[model samples]
Target: MPFKKLHTNILERLERKDITTPTPFQSRSIPVIKSGANVFCAAPKDSGKTTTLILTTLHKLKCEAVGNAPRAVVLVENKEKALELYQAFLTYTKYNSLRVYVGYEELHIDIQKSEIFEGVDILISTPKTMNKLFLLNGVSTSQLKIFSIDDAGFLIQKSDSSAIISITQSIQKCQYVLYSEELHPKLKRFESYFMEHSKIIQI
Candidate 1:
């Protein structure tokens, strides 16, 4: 896998951080992702999908330096899941100059009280929060490089029709990666929508 062959910078970063071996999901998906293809990965929990996405997003961000308009990489997941992912990304990219933010159910409350997502490069959010932010014009999707959905099937099943529509409408040109444990029938419909040229890899 060409993509699995980490770049010199990324490999050096991993080595400095004591991350030598790639996980199963990373070994399989990284190569395909680096090939610049849309990917849909189905694997069990704790299979390293999150780490793969974080690393890939970092690689993309580094390759295409953020423009003046603040390019962002978005991850949409559940509220409970957001915290874990946020912490993981923070730990993984500690040495990198990446800015991470968490947008979940009550992000508005924080925004109303104080500034929340200023200078955020990576956003981990839920569907509802993302829909609200899209509606309020708080975040711009135009500069997004990576649009990821972790536990995508679960999120789609839990999301309202309008929310789903809003999120899909906001992100048009992003390279998408959808991860889930099981592929639901409902999520398959999105293949024709957001993901046209997609590869489904079961781990």
Candidate 2:
């Protein structure tokens, strides 16, 4: 019944996609995420981790567009993952009012700023790009609600972890969720930065 806890629009989309029966990971993690806690979701591939990310994000936003600033931010490893996740989100958001925007280094900061200023509900980007956006005041965190990192094993790098820490420092308060195939030690270190008192869901 985790899917039932989602927004009506999201539930409708899930039904349309014939996505009933939650994977063990989704069944366990979705409710914890819905509770608005910082979570580290560890699961193997094809266990519906990404779907849980998309579903909980939509549920948090109430499946609708709001202010110009993004309420949800999703961080990925690089441009390819950013674009792939963007497409995946689109399949769920296409019939709803929520607006999803993707950003990476290839796109000019000015263009991203202008488009985001116009309006966006969920903002997806690489850690470096997101740090740059925060530094330049390209996006507002005043309304931010949730910040999730997808396939976060990449954070093992010094540069990427540095960027992520910088971004978290700028945000006042928000839920942070990290999804990965395994719980890397480096990721656990994030408890000091933004994952304070975090919950872990392993499947």
Candidate 3:
């Protein structure tokens, strides 16, 4: 199916970077994504999962104004991955007025307990640190629209299920988008929790 028409602002931002064509994964998944369904995309590395996630999130952000703080959270594996994801989001949504924040264990001091989420629209961070922040009331999932887990297999393999469970339970009603190069055994164990009616795109 053709991708549902994205918001004009999102289309403009995508075009600004010459991103006019959807990757195979995007083409197959965008339609379901527009319907607000949970998606699980398992593709080899460099299949454009990051771009798909960022673009979808940007489209959503453009479709509606974010609340007082971030309404989307992206749980990654480590500091390096967090930074990489943050940079990608900035590049795609640079033309739009969206507040993006990156939180990691090393940057705990820089994140204020009370106002860490103030003015933030998207968060990219490790599950452990994000869970801590959520527990400390640094962020809330009540208004969240998107909950993504990039490199999801890695997070599950690292035995970070506790944090993942916490985050998922908190945002139970939010649309979930999970991406991974390969599904690990541990991740397969959580299939019931993350894969209900989820569309799996294998590239």
Top-TM-score structure, candidate number: 2
Q: Which number leads on lDDT?
A: 2
lDDT by residue (75-192, candidate 1, tens digit) is: 5556778888888777756766677778678555458213433566677877777777777767777777777787776655545434765677767687878888877777767777
Q: What is candidate 2's TM-score against the reference?
A: 0.99
Scored by CA lDDT, what does every candidate get? Answer: 0.70, 0.95, 0.76
Give the range where candidate 3 is weakest over 10 consecutive residues by summed lDDT. 108-117
Worst 10 residues of 2 by lDDT: 1-10
lDDT of 3 by residue, 82-144 (tens): 999999888866666787888788885335454554667888889888888778777777778
Clashing pairs in 1: 3-31, 4-31
RMSD per candidate (Å) reads 2.8, 0.6, 2.1
Using TM-score as the yardstick, the better of models 1 and 2 is 2
TM-score of 1: 0.85
Clashing pairs in 2: none
